[model samples]
Target chain A: MKNINLLAMLSLLAILWSCGDDDDAKPAEFGTFQVYFDNKVGADDITRRDNGSTEYDFETSTGEKFNLSLLGYYVSKITLEGPNGEYFQDEMKASASEAKGYYHVLEGESASQNIKLEQVPAGTYNKITFAIGVEEDGVLEGAAGGVLDPADGAWFWNWNAGYIGFALEGTAENSGQEYVDWGGGRETLENTFAIHIGGWKDVADNENFINNIKTITLDFGTTVKVGPDLSPLAHLVTDAMKVLDGAAIDFSNTFSVHAPKAGKPFAEQLPQVFSVHHVHQSTSGHD
Target chain B: MISKTKKYLVYGWVLFLFWSCSDDDAASPKDIYAFEKPAHFPDATYTFENNPITKEGFELGKKLFFDPILSRDKSVSCNNCHQQSRAFADSPLHPTSIGVDNRVGIRNAPPLANLAFMQEFFWDGGVTHLDFVPINAIESDVEMDETLVNVVKKLNEHDEYPLLFEKAFGVKEITSPFMLHAISQFTAMMVSAGSRYDKYVLEGTALSNEEMAGMKLFEKKCATCHSGELFSDFSYRNNGLNDSFGDLGRGRITEDEADHGKFRVPSLRNAELTAPYMHNARFLTLEEVLDHYDGGMVDSPTLDPLFKDGDQVVGISLTTEEKTSIIAFIKTLTDRDFIAEPKFRNND
Candidate 1:
C-alpha cells in the first residue's frame, strides 16, 4: 500500500510539472506616450499659408536663416520607465509605406505623433526612450511587419535598400540663398550621420545618442506630451548637416552596407557641427 | 493519465514554440543578383549601396531589356539590335539599328561587355557613367524612344511590375532609381572574361601557331591604343577610318574641331562575334577590317599620329597569309561561356 501511494504521488507530480510547462503566455502591456514637436520660433507665432504651401521662418544660433519646409523622422524601440523603477518596452517596427515619412517632413508647423502600445503591463512610468532613426541592426539584419515594413515606405524603397531616418529640407537665405537639405538613408549604416554635440571623448562623452531617451512620469490614467520643441533633436540634424557640409561622407566609400564585408565605419567626428537644446515635457490629467 | 491542465500546458508550449520559430524564420526580401567577383578579375568598381542587387530587380531589368515596351511604338527593345550571339552588338546585316517607324540610328550597336571598366559610354563618350547610359538609349529618338516618366508610368500600370519592384526594392511603387539600378545590375553582370585568349593568359595554355603569330602582329601594330586588361584603353583615337562623315564622332560631344573623327578604341574581345565593325559598321568582315588597316586608310588632318609613317599608311605590306593569322587570333577572343551563361539569358 505504501509503494502504491508513493508511485501515485510521483505520477501526479510529473503530470503537474508537464501541465505547468505552458509557453503561450500573453505579452506584457506597456503605456503609451505622445511626442510633440513644437515649431514655434516665437511665443505667439502662427504659420500663415499662401496657396497650398505654408512656410515658417527661423534662424539657427549661427544666424543661418531658413524657411522650414519639411521635418519628419523615424522613431522605434519605444520603452517607458515606471515609478517603481520598473520598465515596459514595445518594439513597433515601421512599415515601408510608413517609413516613407522619414524621407520628407510636413510643411511648416509643429506636429504631434502618437505611438500606440498594447499589452503593456500597467505601471507608473517616469521615462520614455526610443531611437530617433532606424537602428543599424534592424536595417542590416532586416525587420518584418510593423513600422519598418516596406509597404509603409519606412525603408529606403527607391534605393532598393535600408531606411531613412530624418529628412529636413528648406530654403536657407542666410547661406547665400542656397537650399538646406540634410537627410540620411538606411542603405549604408556606417555612413549615416551621427549627431555628437559638445565635449571631447577624453573629457566628457557628450555625444548625443542616436537613440534619444526622455524621462517623464506617467500615472495609469494620464497623458504626457513628449516633444514640443525641436531643440533636443536639433543636434542630430545639425550634426548630420555638418558632416554633409564638411564633405566627410565619401559617396564612393560608404555607398553600400548590405554585408559586413563592406567594412565602412560610422561617422565619429560629428560633435564639431551640431548643438543640443533642453528637453521639456508637460502632463495632462486623465479620468 | 494526463489532466486537462497538463494537456493545455503542452498545447501552449507547442503554440509558443511555433510562433517563436515563425518569427525567427521570417523570410528576408530576396536580392536581385548574387554578385560574385570572378576569381580572375580584379575588384569591381561598382558598389551596391547606390544600387543594391536583387534577383527580382535583375529579372525585371532583363525583361525590360528584351521587351519592346521601351520603344515609342513598341517595336524595339535594347535587344533588338544587341543580340547575344553577336556578343550583344548590332546584327552585321543591319548596319544601323532600326527604331520605331523604321527610323535608323547613326551608329552601330557596340558589344555590351566589360562596361563597368569604361570611364565613358558610347562612341562619342557623351555619357560618363554606365548608370546614365540607359537614359540615352531609352530616351533617344533612334533607340527605345521612350521617356523615363512614361516608362515609370507604364511600369506602374503593369500588373507584374509593382510586385517585382517590391521584391527587388522592398517597395510596391516603381521608382526611377530602382529601374535604373535594376538595369545596371543586369548590365554589370554581363562580364565576358572567359575567351580562349583569357584561358591562355590565366590557365597557361598554349595558343595555336596562327594565333601566336597574330598576337605578335597585334602587339607590334595595334596594342598601343588597344592595350589593357579590358582590351581598350577607353581613349578616343582617330583611327583614320574616315576623313569625314556627316557625324563628326567625338568632336560633336566636345564641340572642338580638333577632336573630329575621334572615336573610342573598340575592344577586340568577341571581335569575331560582333562583325561589320567600327562606329558606322562600314566593314562587313574581318578581311574588310584588315583591308582597311592594310591599304584603305583615309587621310585627314586629325589622323592619329601613330599611323602617320609609311609603315602605318593605308596599305601595310601584309600578305594574305598574315591577315589569315591575325583573323585566327581575333577569333580566339570569342567567349563561349559569356553567351551560354544562364545569368545573361532572358529570365522570363
Candidate 2:
C-alpha cells in the first residue's frame, strides 16, 4: 500500500510540472495600421522660381487645385490609441535621410508615402496621436540620437545650433513681380525670411499647431493586412493649409510669439482646421 | 509538510535571485561626471549635445588622438604636431607642421589645450566649434589629407572600434556622430587651470620679481585685448603680422575687407611652451615675437588702432629687458600637471 501511494505522488508531481510549462507558452500576434497628414488647401502655397521669382497660389474649397509641390515637413512621435485606451507606440522616429524619409511630391502627383509599423501588439485602436513636426521641447533640451541628429542635416541651421521643424522650400511671387525663393529655419529668432515655427516657451503662439490631435479608429481581427486610404492624410494637410490662410493667421507665432509663459492659439484654430476632413472608415478593411 | 514547504521556499528564492541578477545586468551604464563649469569663466558657448562625454567616449577619443591611422598614409597623428610636453603646440624648430608625404602646412598648428573654453577655433576663426575642428585638420591638403567619410569607414572597419562604439553608444555600428563625439570627449577634457599663474590668482601664491614686473607690463599693454581667465577676448584683430600673406584670415569667412588681416587673438596660457609665433609661423622664438610686437607692426587699412599713431604706423615700443620680463611672466602660465596627466595619454 505504501509503495502504491509513493508512485501516485511522483506521477502527480510530474503532471503538475508539465502543466506549468504549458501555461508559460504564448503565441505572437501583430496588427497593421496607418496614420495620415493632409496638406492641400489650408494655407498659401508659396513657390519660389529658379530666377528668384515668387508666386502664391491660394486654395479654393469648391474646386480642388492640386498643390503637391509644397508638401514637405517632418512628422514624428506616432502613437495609436485603442478602443480600450491601450496605446501602441512606434519606437522608430522618422526623418529625412539619404537612404530613407526623402519625399518629393511634384505638382499633380500623389504626395504620400506609406510607412510600415511592424511588430505592433494586436489590438483595436481609436485615436492616432502624433506631432506635426519634431517636438520643440525635444530640440531645446538637447536630446541627442534619433532622426533629428544634427550630423544628418535634418536639424541643421548652417551655423546656428538648432533644428528646422517645418522646412517649406519653393518660389513665392513677391511684390516686385519676381519669384523670391524663401527657406526658413524652424526657429525664427534672427532671420526674417524663414518661418521657423518652433520654441518651447511660446511654441503654440509662435508655431501653427493647426494640425494636432488627429483621430482614426482601426479594428484588426487576426490577419496580415495592407489597408488603402493611407494617402488621405496628405489631403488633410493641404486642407489645413487653406483654413490657416483664410484666418490670415501666422502659424509661426500662433501659440506664443514673445514670452515663455504664454498660451498657444491652438484652442482657437484647431477646430476650424480639422473640421474640413470628416472621419471616414473602409468597409472592406483587409486589402 | 514542513519539508515540502521549505523546498517550495528555496525554489521561489532561486527564481527571484536569477531574475534580480538579470535585471542588474540589463541596466545601462551611468555617466561618470556632470558637465562642470569653472567659476572664473562665463557660461560655455558650446555644450556637449553633439558629443556627450562618457568615460568610454573620452577614452576612445584619446585613442584616436594618438593613432596615426587618421592620416592618409598613416604617417602623422594629431599628436605629432600637438605634443603634450610643449603644451600640445608645435616645437620652436618646426615653424610649419610637416604632414604626410613631407607636405608643409602654411600656418602653425596651435596648442590643443584649454580649447573647451574657446568660442572660435584657428587663427582665421573660420571654423566655429570644437566638433568641427578635427574636420579642418583631417581634410586640409597639408594636414591629414583624409575625408571624414573615409576616416569614419576606417574606424568602423577596425576590429576594436566596433566594441568601443558599443561601449560609448549602445549601438555596434560606428557613426560619424559617435566618432566626432568621442574625439570631442577627449578634446573637452583638456583643461589647464593648475598653472603657477592660476595659483597666484586663486591661492594667493607669490610670483618671482621678473614675473611680477612682466605682469605689470602685461596689465598695461596686453590685458586690453588678451583679457580675462582664458587670456583671450575671442575676437579677430589685425595684430600686424604682415600687410600681406595673400591669406586674408577672417576676411575669407565674412567676405569683408575690414577683416582682411584680422585673426582671432590666441590665448597666452601656454605661450611660453608653444613657440614659432604669429599666424603664418613666421617668428621662431619668443624673443622674435617680442621684437615683432616692439617694432614689427605693419600699417594697413584694417589694422587695429591699439598700436596706431596719428599716421597708424605698425609697432609697440618695449625695452629689451621689458620683453624678457614679459616672456618670464608667460612661463608661469605653464601647467605641468596638465602635460603629465595620464588621462590625456593614448590608451592604445
Candidate 3:
C-alpha cells in the first residue's frame, strides 16, 4: 500500500512539472515601428546639394523668401515610451564599421529620413524622446569609427574639436549682400549666410565644457500601437526657421554661429522644434 | 534528494559566478601599486577609478605604443618621435617629428611623463583628457596620418591584438574605447616622482651645494609658473617669445584674441633630457633657454604679467651665475629609474 502511495505521489509531481515550467514564465513579444522625420525650411521640402551648387527654395513664417544649399544634422539616442511602463531604449551605438542607433538627417538623403526600430516591446506607445546631436560622452570618447568618425568631414570640427549639431549652408537674398569665403575656402558664396550651430556646456565646478544636448522629447499626437498585426508610423517634422523665432536678434545682424555664445539662443529653440505631425495604426489585432 | 556529486557541482558553479562578479566591483584596487604617486606631489587628475589599471592591461598598452601599425604607412610609431632613451621627447635634431610619408609636424613633440597630473594635452591644450591625446597624433596629416577607424580594422584583423584586447577588456571584439583606455594605462604608468629632486624633498635625501642653490633660485624666480613637485601650475600664458602670434597657441584652441600667443606651461620634469626646448624647438640647450628668459623677451599683448614691468618685458631677473646654478637644479629632475622601468618597455 505504501509503494502504491509513493507511485501516485511521483506521478502527481511529474504532471505538475509538465505544466509549462519555463516557457510560460512571461514570454516576451516584440514588434516593428518607424519614426519618420520630414525636413523643411518652412513650407517647402528641404534638399541637400553635396557638390557644385544646389538651391533650397522655402519661405519663413513672415513670408520671407530664402534659399538653402546645405542642411544636415544628427538625430541620435532615441527612446520609445510605451503604455504600462514598457519602454524601448535604443542601443546608442556607432563605430567606424556601422551605426546601430545614430541617424544623420539630411535635406535630400533618404537613408536617414526614416529611422526604423525593431524588437520594440509590443504595446501602445505615446511618447518618443531623442537627442538632436551627439552627447558629451560621445564627443570626448576620442577616435570614434563609423557614423561617429571625425573623418566623415560633414559632421565634426577638426582643429577646435567638436561636432556641428545643426549645420545649414546656403545663400539668402536677404543676407545683406555679404559675400565672403565660407570655412576659409569651401567656395566664395555670394549673398550667403551659414549657421553652424554647435556649443558645449560646463558643469558646476568642472573646467571642461561639452557641446551636445541629451534630451529632446516629443508626444506622438496620438497613441501608436505596435503588435504582431499592428505596425504604427510616427511622422515628425524639423523646421529650420524656428531657431530664429523669438531670439530677439535679427538674422541680418548675425547669421554665423560656431560656438555657445551665438548658438545657445538657437539651441534653446531646438527642443521646441520637434513635434509629431501624425501617427498611423491599422485596425487589425495581434494575429 | 539530489546526488552528492550534483549538489557539489551546483555549489561550485555558484561560487564561480560570485568570483567572476567581483571584477565589476569599482572600489577594489586592481593593483597595490598601479599608479605609483609621490607623497609630495598633488593628487592625480585622471579618473583612475573608472578604468583601473591591471598588469595585463599595462602590458598590452606597451605593445601598442611600440607598434607602428597605427601609422598610415606602417612606418611611424609613437616611439619614433617619443623615444624612451630621450625621456620620451622628440629627437633633438628633428625640431618637428617626422611622420609617415616623411611628413613633418608643425610643433615639436612634447615629452610624455607625469601626464596624469596635467590638466590638458598638446601645446594648445586642445585635448582635455589623457585618453584623447593619442587621437590627435594618430590623425595628424603629418604625424601618424592614420584614421582611428582604420586602426580598429587593423587591430581586429591582427591575430594577437584581438586576444590581448580580450584579456584587457573582457569583450570578444576589440573596440576603440578599450584600446584608448589601454593606451592611457601605459601613459599613466610614466610617473617620474622618483627623481633626485623628489628624493631630496619628500625622502629627505641630500643634495649638492650647487643643486641646492639652483633649487632656491628656481623657487624664487620660476616657481610661480613651474610650481609644485610636478613642476607646473597648469596655466596657459604667453612668455613674450614673439611680438605677434604665428601659431596662436592657446588662442587658436580657445578662439579668444586675449589667449593668443599663450601656450601651456610645460612641466619641468626631466627637463635635462627633453632639450631643444619651447613649442618650436628654437632653444637647443639649457643655457640658450636661460639666456632667452634672462633677457631677449619680446613685447606682446598677451604676455604674462610676471615677465613684464609696465611697457617693457623684464623677463626673469637672474645673473649668469644664477642661470648656471638653476641648470644644475633642473638636471636633478631627470628620473632615470622611472624612464627605464622594464614594465614600460616593449616585451611583446
TM-score leader: 3
Model 3 misses residue A175 by how many Å?
11
Best-to-worst DockQ order: 3, 2, 1
Worst 10 residues of 2 chain B by lDDT: B23-32
lDDT pick, better of 1 and 2: 2
Model 3, residue B69: distance off in Å is: 2.9
DockQ, each predicted model: 0.03, 0.04, 0.15
Worst lDDT run of 10 residues, candidate 1 chain A, spans A194-203
Judging by lDDT against the true structure, name the best candidate: 3
Which candidate would rank higher by lDDT, 1 or 3? 3
Error of 2 at B290 (Å): 2.0
Between candidates 2 and 3, the one scoring higher on TM-score is: 3
Tens digits of per-residue lDDT for model 2, B1-348: 875665565555555544544533313444333445556666665556445577788888888889888888788888989999888998776688888788888778898877777766788775545665676677666888776667867888998989988888777677665676678778887888889998998788999999999999988878888889888897888988777748788665454567788888888888878887877887777889888888887878888888888885746789999998888988898899888878787666
Global lDDT of model 2? 0.59
lDDT of 3 by residue, A66-116 (tens): 666777788878889966776888886543244567777876766667777
RMSD of each: 14.1, 12.5, 7.5
> Compared with the true structure, what per-residue lDDT tens digits does model 3 show for residues B192-309?
7778988898879999999999999999998999998878887888887888878899776666677889888889999899878898887999999989898978887888999988
TM-scores of chain A across candidates: 0.46, 0.49, 0.78
Chain B TM-scores across candidates: 0.87, 0.88, 0.90
